[model samples]
Target: MINIQSGIPGFDQLTVSELTEGGIPEKSTTLIYGPPKTGKSIFCNQFTYNGLSNQEPCLYVSTDQGYKQVQRDMTDFQWLIQNYIQNQTIYFIDGISHLSGGKFENKNNIVSSSVSNPADLMVKVGIGTRNVYKTSNHFRSILDSLNTLFAFNPDQMVIKILKAYLRRITEAGGTGLIAYTEGITDPKTENELKSLFNNTIRLDGQHIHIKSDHPDFDEVQYFESTYTITDNGIVVNENNFKNIN
Candidate 1:
């Protein structure tokens, strides 16, 4: 099976290697959900940096912040993606730019577009993906914090849009990582959304759990793996914290 190596060392060791072929499964989408401040965004940043480092083009859709903020955040973590941005290997769809004084003047001529709503986001994503595909056949996309989309659109509408968009990612031979926040929806609604993805990475505070239909995964052994976010990225503790539920 095709796979892409996630840059985070601990994630690759504790989850990726055990669940898939030494990395995230290619042509499939993985949902990353967790409470706020649990390093979900950091995980995504690390993944994108890894992809860019490997010469895989990336499309990052930001529903919560502008592309500059994302750049600043990653830079703080010492994951400098500015070079990728300059070369157009990494593209962005900024959904919050309109909210914050419209689109900021992009002096770098980076491959990014601004969207005001979910409808616009869909259109921009389609355009963004097509553009990125021109750079490489194998690419990755990330939707940072799906919670913002849920806040503005009906649950069903968001799910419908996400499902279609995710399918497009897979069809184009690309992998996707969608970050989501837990406790925003009821359990039933949450489960429904989770069911759409090929894999689920749940971050609960300092503990993380991965669930997949792949038979090789030993659910009992991998449950509630402990981790801490450092400047480099996620660092998984060797001892699993079984009681952190």
Candidate 2:
């Protein structure tokens, strides 16, 4: 049985046993939640790149940044860019524009101009829409940012998109990591989405918490890892967490 491990080197020393014990549950979905600048995206990138290095194709659907920007950011991590990112084992889909519903410049003109033909308007709307469809059928993992979707519509509509996305990934026999910002504070909404995931990881400053749905596993565990932004990537120093039981 292949063990699911965090891509970070020393960090795996903290989570290897648990992940190897039950094989990290096949088709598992995890949510990494944290406030802004709390290393959520970095963590997502690590997982995606790790899967790629393992010869597992990974998809990174970005709702916040463009393809070029993401590439530029990853350049800081030499290993990431040279080993996996540049090798095309990892794919990127920019969905940031979709989160805005439609382009503001295009919508303004349509609204300002007295175009009475609803059909024409519908066509124009469709033309302005941005849809990102995956080309590859086999992907071992997908990392998507939920913050953009929530910014688009805070209603139940976002939930529908999330469910569809998750279903697509799992149906393809791949694991996925969906990230949500800590801004959404409604417990009911959080729980509703949480039920869809097999695992949930929370990041707060330097603290990391993992929660699993399986009863036999440690449902809740904490790690005192220093979340540092380095040139190579986001490094997690788990040596300080002696009480990680």
Candidate 3:
């Protein structure tokens, strides 16, 4: 049986099975990169929310959408994360607020940063995640999209920052996911990110593709599946998903 499952229906049963045999390996990081409107945010939400529901401490680092907007998105999708926030099972790091003229937050589980590189954002995440580790031995984290940071910092600088923080997660024995916005960061850099993360997946319309050269994954595995954004929460054709190479 898969030990750690992606909350998405077809996902855990297929690609993760194809890639890792088991579910996403613990103490690892996966990159979910793609253009907008392709359910990237929902994918991350589903992962973190699943961990939270399992009584595992979860940390959400929002670089693109602020925590409130993520909350709204989860609400629209009917995942309902507010209770997790209320009980502190889930901690949040908001990186978009200060850039948008909002004040910084340092108190409570919901912390805010000044919208900077992973160095600054990492500090906020480190603080919140450290707290989560106080009582829990395992956790899952997500940096919604690093594309926001890439827009300002040099790709090399951004890459170094991500490498350092991801190493931190590995040392702490937690799984992480960092999303990438399609077509914004250069293709060369994107390829570098694919190499760095080792496990990378692409979200395109109703099609999800996995691209990697690792021995564990072959070339571009694509899956045809559908999803909903309403109170239907999330729906996936788990049993009928078609895998096309």
Candidate 4:
């Protein structure tokens, strides 16, 4: 039997039953998809921070901005640089440059190989390394903002990239949450990606709907949670949740 942990407080109360009934493991792949400004990034940050607070190592892969900018934004959530971020157990990989064919090491050189798949790029960039591990213990988590990839076509190259990325994380016995914005409007592509995930979480408005692909589960559950951006970070009011089981 696999035990899945809901990173969100109060939110877990509504999900625990379904997760247990489905037997989804702890170190599994979760997809959080929604429109822009729906608190996707904040949710990822909170999930990552939860792991860090538990003395678990986490890797945050950002395709939209550099590490410095993310760090700055996180500071508003009461996340101190020296205490919670800098040289800590949480590691950040600034993947924004990699999208524009920029070299990971030398910012000057233009990368000849364009990597559409983030999972492959993660390994190429040495994300799973001792240096990355030096920061925390949980040593397992991923947040890939999928907006960058939608710029290209939904071809096998894209699928291969996602597959490679998820495989790397799962193989290492780590769990991950990949974020996808509502850009690639093609239903076929969306369905294909959905097939790859073990669980799918949609943040629509102020509600979070969760679904699992496990055979033991056949129903989708909805929960109400408040989304707020504050100085201390994204605070989710899980206690006010009501399950749509």
Which prediction has the highest lDDT against the true structure? 1
Models sorted by lDDT, best on top: 1, 3, 4, 2
Candidate 3, which segments miss by more than 4 Å at Cα? Answer: 16-22, 211-234, 239-245
Where is model 3 poorest over a 10-residue stretch in terms of lDDT?
211-220
Model 3, span 91-192: residue lDDT tens: 888888878887665658988774564577777767776877774768888888887888777889888888877887667767888888888777898788
User: Which digits, one per residue and each the tens of the lDDT, describe model 1 over residues 23-85?
Assistant: 576777889998899989999999999999999999888888788889999999888998888
Tell me the TM-score of model 3.
0.85
lDDT per prediction?
0.78, 0.57, 0.73, 0.61
Q: By TM-score, rank the candidates, best first.
A: 1, 3, 4, 2
Question: If scored against the real structure, what TM-score would every candidate get?
Answer: 0.88, 0.72, 0.85, 0.77
Candidate 4 lDDT over residue span 1-245, tens digit each: 36544455544555556446332246678888888887777777767766666667676677666665666766667555445454456655666665665446522111112335555555643544344444433355665576666665355666667787777666666677888886565778788888898778777667676776554456554445555555555445655655556
Greater lDDT among 2 and 4 belongs to 4
Angstrom error at residue 217, model 3: 9.2
Give the Å error, residue 154, model 2. 3.9
lDDT of 3 at 49: 77
In terms of TM-score, the best-performing candidate is: 1
Tens digits of lDDT, candidate 2, 112-228: 111122233223322222111142444455445776566656547667666766676666656777788886747788788888887777788777666556444554443445556
Stretches of candidate 1 above 4 Å error? Answer: 16-19, 106-116, 214-224, 239-245
Residue 171, candidate 4: how far off, in angstroms? 0.7
